[model samples]
Target: MAYGYTGWGWPTGLRNGMGDAGLALGIIALVLFIAFPLAMILGVLALIFGGIGHARARRGEAGNRGQALAGMICGGVGLVLATLVLVLVVSTGDEEPNGRMDEGGYSATSVR
Candidate 1:
């Protein structure tokens, strides 16, 4: 019997394609976690795609179950990290500088 051959034969290319995309997006999301919001967005997408891939695999309609699982793992971790960063930033209130200068007009102390 062929290895990894399901009785119903191989699933369509699209099924595996989603798994591949999920894996790639998951990796990207993990790497971009430093970007906070963007990472959260990518992580969400990765999870969605991974879920689809996983469903197909569970139904014996596709391969790459490992990839789908990996995607889900990365997406979950990345999303959590991004959310923490966002929360920290919001709580810390790291807003832009007020950009107010002294009215003394080019004082020596200001230059120093």
Candidate 2:
């Protein structure tokens, strides 16, 4: 006997696609968290898509609630980490060197 088609396509629906995209972006953002600019961008997109997907799932418009939630959470954490790294770099960029080096490759300033 031949099985009948269930009529389900690859992505199924827009909301499902959003959930899938969100999950993928979230994972990428997390892995690239060291690159703050890229991570932030991907994280934001993941959050937006995941939020919409999750809302749709909750409303019975989609069926990937867990994936959406995971994406949102990972994106949020990655964004936070990226922001923290940015802050750390900015905060330390203006510090002056502790001491000047002499021709002999030793500190010119003497300890009191």
Candidate 3:
């Protein structure tokens, strides 16, 4: 029975589990998740629409190529915007003082 059941030579693991639909939707979700949050108000519409498009593609109601492309574009833009904002904040922000400043006009004269 063991010798006759030699169907182990089949290339099953080499293929995908969810095929193109899964890839398309997954990419869209991941990209939008990264982009929308990073972009703040700029990528809000893109995220919303990209999500809808991905869903539609998964359902076979829309094209996946477009959906995936849009998602990547929006996500990239958002990420860049978010990075820029972070850089600006870091560059312009001041460090908190460790010690309190003296309100009195005490000069740093040498005391004997």
Superposed Cα deviation of residue 108, candidate 2 (Å): 16
lDDT of 3 by residue, 1-112 (tens): 5556666586533222223433443344345443434355444444555566566667766555464446546554665666666676666555335545543655568435
List clash counts for every candidate, in order. 0, 0, 0
- Candidate 3 yields a Cα-based lDDT of 0.50
Better of 2 and 3 by lDDT: 2
Tell me how many residue pairs clash in candidate 1: 0
Q: Give the Cα lDDT of each candidate.
A: 0.85, 0.86, 0.50
What residue runs in model 1 are displaced by over 4 Å at the alpha carbon? 1-15, 94-112
After aligning candidate 1 to the native by TM-score, how far in Å is the CA of 23 from where it should be? 1.0
Q: What is the lDDT of residue 53 in candidate 2?
A: 90
For residues 31-74, write the lDDT of model 2, one tens digit per residue.
89989999999999999999989988999988889999999988
Best by lDDT: 2
Across 26-54, the per-residue lDDT of candidate 1 in tens digits comes to: 89989999899899999999999999999
Question: Against the true structure, what is each candidate's TM-score?
Answer: 0.70, 0.72, 0.37
- Clash count in backbone of candidate 3: 0
